[model samples]
Target: MGVRVLGPRDLSAARAVIARDPVVNVFVDSLVQTSGLDPRRGAEVWGYVEKGVLEALCHAGGNMVPVGAGEAALRAFAAYALRRGRNCFQILGPARAVEVLWEALEPHWGPAREVRDDQPFMVIDGPPVITPDPLVRAVEPVELPILYPACVAMYTEEVGVPPQTGPDGTFYRSRVAELIRTGRAFARIEDGKVVFKAEIGSVGTGVCQIQGVWVDPERRGEGLAAPGMAAVVELARQLTPVVTLYVNAFNTPARAAYERVGFRTVETFATILF
Candidate 1:
């Protein structure tokens, strides 16, 4: 088997490999489109080909962000990425592969901080039991003031970064609005106030990724996440056979809520932010 940088000629095979793994595939497609990063540039999607058959795939781009793949293929891909002088790397994949890659690369990049711990990439199958919540519903166009604050609060509190403001805020809002425009955003409103929100990202090959799940602090103990999440899952299921989302390993409450909504842990991934 041999490994090499993906070129335009490799798109067909690359697409096929991506299609086989929908969660990572959707994320890759979204990154290519939303981040304005050209997959044809420093970006490379490497495949392990044996006897004219592609058996494994790995992707590296933009500071060497690495997504999951087979161990042998990833090791080969990392060799190529390091040759380009990319020291910083992020690995989102199975726990074993991550541990192996991190150990192998320690000689080059030193110790890697666990920016995101070994959290599960969960998938929701079957109809979700969305409990009735007076505060949960679809967000409307006229409720930006109510909705924006709730979103900002959740983003800052849960994500540990202040909500983007000014130009950055504009970009963030536009990105969210694009998702809403594409029928991806869902919310729960009570007394005309938005309290919780969730959205699914791009859908391809029967897999949709859930993103930006949030709830008002005051509404946390009220059991609002499951239903709000359920609504999003139900909506995404229209386009795909399964819905997937990632949660921080340390956030037990969020993990419990997701499990209540029929999501099961499938794989553990590490997000290394430098």
Candidate 2:
């Protein structure tokens, strides 16, 4: 039993592993599909192979996501990350997988800066139960200036860090722009201000993971999140077979809004932010 680095030559094998759970695996699937398993792009995949058969895989670098896991494989992947001085932004996946991997990682890596231990991994298999908000629509290129502030506010509020941690906010701005370019960004604009917003954070492996959902602070009690989310899910389904997202269990209002929009808790996810 050994874990080895995977590269472009292992693309088919990687695809097969990711396909096992398209929703939970889309972030890694997108990386491998677009970056081709290359370390050059600051991301690489490692496979837990035994007897020449790949049993599990771990994605390292930007996000330390593990898929197709087993105890042995998860432990090995964690050890590898420890050895490489892993500084990935988060470790997210099925609760069991992330838990086992973290068990191996935490002893050596020390305390996590932040953790959402009870994130509800939700999915929508069909059209939503709520009516889609007609105001919510795909954000256009011209609206980036109007939408960028809302995106920044949402990211900062949800993640507990200023997205402009870079020299001039260029890194965060470019990332939001890239999502908009892909037509994955959506928002409800009213009077030239974004009132509600969401984005497809990952797109691959027949799924899209929605993230960065937000409603303006003043509009919080206006009953916008449910219908707004319904619209977002409808738009997201046009690009993938399904939509998935993980929300902190403590966020009761968000949870209720999502349930009203037809998303069910399919699994549990844990996220450790470094």
Q: Across residues 1-274, which tens digit of lDDT does each residue of candidate 1 receive?
A: 6776556665666566666766655676555434233454545666667678676665565334344367776677667656765534356555666666666676787565535657788987788865534444556656666667666776777656665565645866765666666777778877876678887766656677887888777778887887777777777788788788888888898998898888998877666543
Error of 1 at 268 (Å): 2.4
Model 1 clashing residue pairs (backbone): 136-188, 137-187, 137-188
* Per-residue lDDT of model 2, residues 1-274, tens digit only: 7888998888888889888877778778878888888788757789999888888889887688898888988988887787788768888888888888888888877588887789999999799888999999998988889989998899889989877457775888888888899899999999999999999998896788999999999999899999999999999999887899999999999999999999999888889887
Pairs of colliding residues, candidate 2: none
TM-score for each predicted model, relative to the true structure? 0.79, 0.96
Question: Model 1, residue 244: displacement in angstroms?
Answer: 1.2
The per-prediction tally of clashing pairs is: 3, 0
After superposing candidate 2 on the true structure, give the runs of residues whose Cα lies further than 4 Å from its correct spot: none
